[model samples]
Target: MTDTSEMDRRAELSEFLRNRRARLKPEQAGIQPFGGRRRVPGLRREELAYLAGMSVDYYIRLEQGKVRNVSEPILEALTRALSLSEDERAYLRNLVKPSHRRPVSRPKVLPGLLRLLDMAEGVPAYVVGHRADVLAWNGLASAVFTDFAALSPRDRNWARMIFLNRSVQAVFADWTSKGRDTVAYLRVQAASHPGDAELAALVGELSVKSDHFRTWWAAHHVRDHARGRKRFIHPLVGEMTLDFECLRPADGGDQTLVVYTAEAGAASERALRLLANWGADAATGAEAGEPEVGRL
Candidate 1:
């Protein structure tokens, strides 16, 4: 609303466009490099404009944040020229045409959702808010991963745990891949809710705390957290591979219900059973006021 805020938004838009353009190589945009040595790392402004079927001056104005009335066709052309992913394309559109509505408050898991999570027997299920904060989790999920109940509310963020928690790092077979994907997913959320102070704080904290996160964030990669195969090396069970699906509630808040399941009669299934048993024991211990020792 203020002049300073408007300037900040435009500056952010400029930086995002520059970063995306810098990541696109000339060859990737079907452009042949000249004989002279180039100073830039990626496609030059003119090269990108040529690939997008637009004039160099027009593209320059768009990148400079001087053109606020960008058309859909032009945005689509830019998306294609930059080889943007679905999430990245959505983010770009949001930057050009931001919603007038304010950012929503942090979402809470509903009672029905908690009941459903509890009823999801033999499956590990958890609810994560827009910022990837673990709002709620079933006992099976706690056993399969880290115990969310043991963690403080502020420390329950998936992004923070992935970077700072050794137990979480140990569980993931490919930590780097998972970390990059997580950061990219968060980047999409940040673009959608640019005014969310909590999200901004999380990003700032992560950037200061983890070099890996800082580098990945600068890359501006974006991904939808829908479905994927996750491999884990459990401390109790040797190794397990699980299929995970992310579900959004019909109520349409920023909460996602993620469920992980193992294939029937497979080794992962047996390992899941072991995890369930251990989880049950852990729950019993908690009921008896014993310290939770199942955390790994």
Candidate 2:
């Protein structure tokens, strides 16, 4: 009897492979099309098998997740044949052979890291650990993004905020793109942390809740968060464009300290300055147990 987890993993593998294969057209792969009514969008099973230099039966079984112990060479062949991105390739490997090690139960927020966020008070900064949990955040981050301190620990996840919180969605100028990226990152996290029941539950909950999440999750897109320019329409500060960087702290147990900065002398810089002052003032005036200004 196949375990439920294993069956779920196999189903994910099959869907991911099929989606990747379906996106590459025959012309894109330099293959000449010979003929009958094309049923699917992209390369057929036999064509992909030919490109990967494997027998059709073997490739079909692999797609069906029936072939266990897939070799390195075979995986490499599939990577090339599908032209998977580095992130996508990593995701594929994880799906084929998931990690068995348990993740840190609760990632600690080091005092030094919190101090660093305090020191850089002018810009918005936050630390996100596994599963996009906003483990630690500065005042400016709450001002620019959301008041993470108010949310329960589980609801502090960026994935949850972006998908479930309508107010958070309104802040991002490119919310659709943001949602897609969040879904893709979560897809990578899901494959990488197969042992994480909380992570799995988060995905399941979002899939049931968000329409966009369900559609994008099925697309199988994968990417790592890096430096990017993002536009935000803050309720207090109005619109501002900021360049953000995701920095992984050494020995911080996979915690990424994300900082957002605007180009000097720009309107965004001025807006950030005003936002920082407002955030500081809000913090000073808040009564004990009072909720912060940015609820979502």
Candidate 3:
């Protein structure tokens, strides 16, 4: 198989292992806990198989994606056996469908939009398509999290940053919720763009690299975060809780601009002002053209 196809397989295997392992509890499995013999927190493979009423061999094969044609009832059994969340159960079903896909296009980044993003200055602004691919982000956006322009193309994945990058992980103080939202957004995106090869690849890569990604992906949670409160710990800005908004075009169904800003008179707003001054000074030093600067 090619690299792209391999990514899909990897994602499938990765997510399966995570979900299967998350459902186990000695008490839940009706086993008496020997004071110190329980090394694993979740259920073992055989235990899970027994609960699902499937042969251990069959379950293992399914988990491995060696058996691809799983029925809905079987999936439901796995969901119940593993105690999967409603979102995860939905995700398991999505993974089996042929139409579910990711992006594979060379992104067409717009100069005007980049300029607008730059203009946002202190306020973080960036655009992502249906697949949650960061098409463009301003310097402040980069300052708050990533500098997309400076990063290698292969490494510009949002999910990877959440699960793989230390800096990104540190930004979200609410890790579990952060994880939930990430899956929710992607689940929604995957549904919106079922044939996007690039997105599929991103999902695939995450599934291969992180078991958490795998489990979450399988759960198939869906959400649209048009407006919400998000907290971030910027190395320069310190702790900040910003309100976020999603702007979508009337003509384009998938494109959205995400803007982050602190509420008026809030401590985070004050911190943002301080960070802005620092950012201006740094921008001056770089001889980089200035983007727009504004208050929250």
Candidate 4:
């Protein structure tokens, strides 16, 4: 790596450790508070070092990103001391020892995958690539989310839409929660793709334009969009709740197939049906009859 990139990596790693440490309370870590006024919100460096069973100087060096080739046992100790979640632990691993990142290239959704999306008739389904790019979408997905087909290629990112698009912001019932999740997902992607200029530019743009994005990015949170429930206040269909599942391909690529489903006999199901009908009508009017798929 270039010196500049190495410095950037070290800085990121340091900030991540600091934020994680700052969120952990001394009491929560079973540390007894001592006699002075505590200046920080969370556990002090010495307390953390004590919990991790390491020397204060060694822990300080690790926290400062000065330690190289951090051992597995040391990492495990820190993981326990910080009480990191599964996703957070994975992110910690990436930061301390990031893998060799491949070149960034536009990911293409396979024709077979497009067909799979089409077959998911009653549900909203889409494919998202490494940078949260909307690589492909089924009709219901376009209806539930914004019309991915209508967006400019660059505007088809979930993070961009969540942070920058007013209509999208209004659609999610809990916009802030959704926004934070988007930010966390982006952080995870950044750790994996440190050399991706487009990804970095996207983060920089969102950080500039959205206060929520800026704050959440600085928090150093990391998450995987594996499965979750989302509430939507869609314009046409008043309100609905849906459960989403993110399925990754066996090859372990960044492409994820996300599908959203509503309860079988719930009001949300009815709303989805209405949205599907509306989407079909909209589809008929378009000169391009097929749903826009694999447009990366």
Best by TM-score: 4
- Candidate 3 or 2, higher TM-score: 2
Question: Higher-TM-score candidate among 2 and 4?
Answer: 4
Off by over 4 Å in 1: 1-8, 33-37, 250-252, 281-296
lDDT score for residue 131 of model 3? 61
Better of 1 and 2 by TM-score: 2
Q: Of the candidates numbered 2 and 3, which has the greater lDDT value?
A: 2
Give one digit per residue, the lDDT tens place, for model 3 in 44-105: 66777777899999977777767767798898887787776765566566565444434446
On the 0 to 100 scale, the lDDT of residue 262 in model 3 is 86
Q: Model 2 over residues 158-201: C-alpha lDDT tens digits?
A: 99999999999999999998999899888888888777888888
Tens digit per residue, CA lDDT, model 4, 188-278:
9888877777888899999899888998999898998799999999988799999999888777777888899999999999999988876
Off by over 4 Å in 3: 1-104, 110-119, 281-296
Error of 1 at 246 (Å): 0.6
Candidate 1 on 80-170: residue-level lDDT in tens? 9988888889988877887554655545466676566667777888878788888777678888888777777778889999999989999
| CA RMSD of each candidate after superposition | 4.2, 3.8, 7.6, 3.3
**Which residue pairs collide, candidate 4?**
none
Stretch of 10 with least lDDT, candidate 2: 283-292
Superposed by TM-score, candidate 1 places the C-alpha of residue 32 at a distance from the truth, in angstroms, of: 4.0
